[model samples]
Target chain A: MSALKRVQQWATFARVWHIYDASWQNPFKSAELLKKYLMGLHKPIYHPMNDCGDHVIVINSGDIALPGDEWKRRVYFHHTGYPGGATWTLAWELHSKDPTMVLRKAVYNSMDGNLQRRYTMERLHLFPDANVPTNLLKNVSNQIQQLKAKPKRLDHYSENQVKQFPKIFDYPKDYILK
Target chain B: MLLNMNMIVPLGILRNVLFQSKFPIRSMRIFPRLQLKEIREVQNEKELVIYGEIVPSERANILLKNTHPQACPLCASGLDVKHTDILIISQFVRSDGCMLPRRITGLCRTQQKRMSSLVTMAQKAGLMPNLNPANSKKDPKKRFQWKKFNKYFDESTIKS
Candidate 1:
């Protein structure tokens, strides 16, 4: 093929990739990997003080999973300051009442307090249902088939990965590896 | 002894043992000891209801912001509204108990003072009932006796 034809084909593939839902189960890992893969953070224009990353559209929020009793025990309290003003509601109750609110609140809380944080927040588009337009990537038959299977969801680790989690010991001696 | 001239009893008097106890029940005071009385008994209905009058949220918000009993005295910042801060304005009771300081309600000092004054004002205005008569304070011994009665009834029900 001529060099001009090859360049045109590559450009078409790039456009298709831009519209694809390269879905990942683990959002943290997905974001981190995509940051490097897409050269979002390494660009000469990259600034730590500013949020300059591309937008990430998250769908199927109802299918998102949490591993522990966080859904039930977590409580949010507020009051109107009148007779019987104070009230308590749980995370599960909030989720059931409004699923989109749950995800939005979670992501917003996860962000730092700054102008950049606001920018990061604006980039996140969350849909409680499968409402996103992924038609651009639909033409890529192989990619679509792979995405149909559950995206390998990433878990955000606060300290370390769960797989290498150290077992709790009542005594210091018990933690010694044989 | 009944026939003794010196031992004459009053014409209409009947000696009852129930009323002869060393600790006679004290009568409840009419004022200072604010107790919740029946609404029908209260002559003024206008003083009772604070809601349904469309009081602006800004007013409540302002009161909460400025004079909340739980706020800090030094700063306008939030502080805990302790049990001590809880003003129990009983209608007839002179002494109102305050709630203890707690971790929640981060009331600043100025707010607490403001709130305390507001509560006192509320009590004086008779807007808030000082106490409920049904929940009036009782002697611990009497409470224990009531518990005993409860236990007896519970046992009887079990037997049946």
Candidate 2:
């Protein structure tokens, strides 16, 4: 192959790294999107056993959102294989212990129940915060869109923005403001 | 003698009692001040604290035009209000992050309940940190443990 053509081939064949912001995203939904890239399902020559050169870097995994009270409601079950060794941990507790654990498990549970699942998970890199290493970050060429829009806090708005917003109703003339 | 009495010096106690009954309206105002009182450590007397309210002319001139006159303000506008809609939710909240009572908001029964719940949800999510109490940590990220993380609410999960 010509020198230019060889370089082009390498560029096309090299692994395409994708970065996804886990902030305010449901990890389960994100896992579905990441699964395609990890397994090369989106490629034309995709096979169940085939390996693809794709890396998904999920940042702010600690900020992944759970739908309503799920943090306290959802429980993770574990056992040591000894009699009376069973233990259950709430989602919040687990997240507090390891910020990335919730998203990691969510992504893991979302995949197929087979040995290949473990291998596929290796391609997924989860970060608790937005501190991805420079080497891995440089390779990222694509960003996966979050399913849900990130929520903005009231305090985030500027004072002028809040003040300029239309008033809902004027307080009664007789009523006193606190 | 009558002409001389017209310019006569009025006694402090007699003049006070004379104007007190005639001009009671002067003592009471249209918009009464807050009735909050404080007892200072230095003095035993209770001090009446008068707070200033925003003048009508100085208020936000830009008000949402309510199209529906019959229906409630929220019901009139067919907006799918979400908890994340802090702009809309903040309108129903007080300076201290408390939801305004239905009487003041003038929302219908359903809207009032829904908005209050949405307000609660937003507050718990630390979305209205600025409107919180004086002792609050203004930054949501500075909250304890899991609370410091970014979390969103499912409106459907809210019980009416």
Candidate 3:
């Protein structure tokens, strides 16, 4: 394909991904896993030199889940190196202190921590609440699609099978009905 | 002469208790399974007195912390739960500390694993302190009575 034709083709096929910040309900979802999926890192077309990454719009980060009593039990430690330099905060405490920050840190930590990481992460929009941001990307033509909810089954296999075997366990002639 | 009697009398009594005492002494100690619940509950306060021993507490804490779901070291979710909240963390064995499984907590296996890793990490991080009194604290040597040595060994005379 010609360069111009390929560019147009690429633009047409370019996708945006919308990731629900189900962290509050599903905190076990690793930021690392999410980053890989959102960054197009798993794709065959991934180019280290080019910004071939997709835009990822994350919503409801404030509600992100952490696996255990980690919200309370785990302590994050930091140090200033002075005599009283070290300080720590419990996971739940940090969430309460700044829920957005707790998520931001997770997302940031998931990145490569290089110069390109800053630019790549810039393409990611993390919202503390479920509401989408209007300024950065807005509800544009390139907006990501909402997730398809899983289908539920109303009638079960057992009920359907009942027609074929009306009385699956037939009582013997000598057996009492009671 | 009186002072000599005071020393000699107790020494004689001690010797009798040690050497003259019959082998096995026909003594019966009712260990009765030595269960804590069977023992009368002491009115004393239940405190986790951590004095000097650091290794076992560190190990237990790491094990407990890693096993806890809410405080898992492997995932981000546990960055918010409590160390003792078994709802977010658990162990194979039921104890005063570990949380029960998710059928009780209503959490899935994913969350459970995350919580457990966090708890284990915390234990490794020394966040969970050793809980046993013997391991947690030791009496100041000066305050420990020499009489307590009787608990560990039988008194015997040395023939020079």
Candidate 4:
């Protein structure tokens, strides 16, 4: 192979490490996106028989947000083969026990239930907070963008900025401000 | 004429009532209320004085001006305000984070309902923690059970 062709082949076949911020994001939605990368769906040479796949490091999994009342409404079911062993856990209850478990299960469940699923999950790394290990941090060369914009808090703005924002409606003349 | 000087009526409404009577509407005069003033009360040694001061609203000079006689101020401005926009939502809120009454806000019935809903969403999202209830948690990040996490609202979910 020519020098340029050899470098191109090495680049396409090499594993790429991607970092994703899970703070304030919906876990189910993030899982779909992460599953594609974990299964090497983005690679041009992706095939069912190919072993090539990318590694995804997700941080702030503890901060995943559920839509509306899903925290209490959604339930995870489990059974241990015995008739009385069946149990259901609320989303929040499960999250309270392990913050990273929710996101880990989300990405795991997003993929097909084939035998290779467990092997594919081995490449996924989840951290409850932003503190990723130095070894894992060094491998991330790409970042996946967050699905939603972080909402700004009113107290985060300077006093001047709030006062300078345009007024929409004025209070009545007789109104007293506390 | 049946005179009740204590009654403070608008000129247009007074004219409509007087048009059917012998009182000459042309002879009447109008003292318009101050558009921008703050009323304050002072207790003197022997008496009380209640007066208004010309106090302009902050940023009044550069506010988005609007004029649509048939529509409310918000509707006339044509602003598609969302729940995440705390700046516009704060205008319709009191110091205690309560929604101002319809009469005070001067918003149409539909807009009033929507604005109140937006206000609720903003509070739920913890965007305006400073104006929340005194007994409530001041830090949104420290809220109880399931609420401490950051959550957002979709404006479409509002019924209006």
| Candidate No. with top lDDT | 4
For all candidates in order, the CA lDDT equals 0.36, 0.76, 0.44, 0.82
Best to worst by DockQ, what's the order? 2, 4, 3, 1
Chain B TM-score of candidate 2 stands at 0.64
Ranking by TM-score: 4, 2, 3, 1
Off by over 4 Å in 2: A1-13, B1-54, B57-60, B141-148
For model 2, residues A79-152, the per-residue Cα lDDT tens digits are 99999999999888998899899888887888789988888889999899899899999988899888888888
- The per-residue C-alpha lDDT of model 2 at residue B75 equals 84
**What does the interface RMSD come to for each candidate?**
29.6, 4.2, 26.5, 5.1
Residue lDDT tens for model 4, B68-110: 7678889999999988889889888876799999988889999
Candidate 1 lDDT at B63 equals 31
- Give one digit per residue, the lDDT tens place, for model 3 in A36-89: 655678667776775566666677666554443355556768899899999898
Alpha-carbon lDDT of model 1: 0.36
Tens digits of per-residue lDDT for model 1 on A134-158?
6522443322121223311112232
TM-score of chain B of each: 0.23, 0.64, 0.25, 0.66
Deviation in angstroms for B87 in model 3? 20
Sort by lDDT, best first: 4, 2, 3, 1
How many clashes (backbone atoms < 3 Å, residues ≥3 apart in a chain or on different chains) does model 1 have? 48
Candidate 2, residue B71: the lDDT equals 88
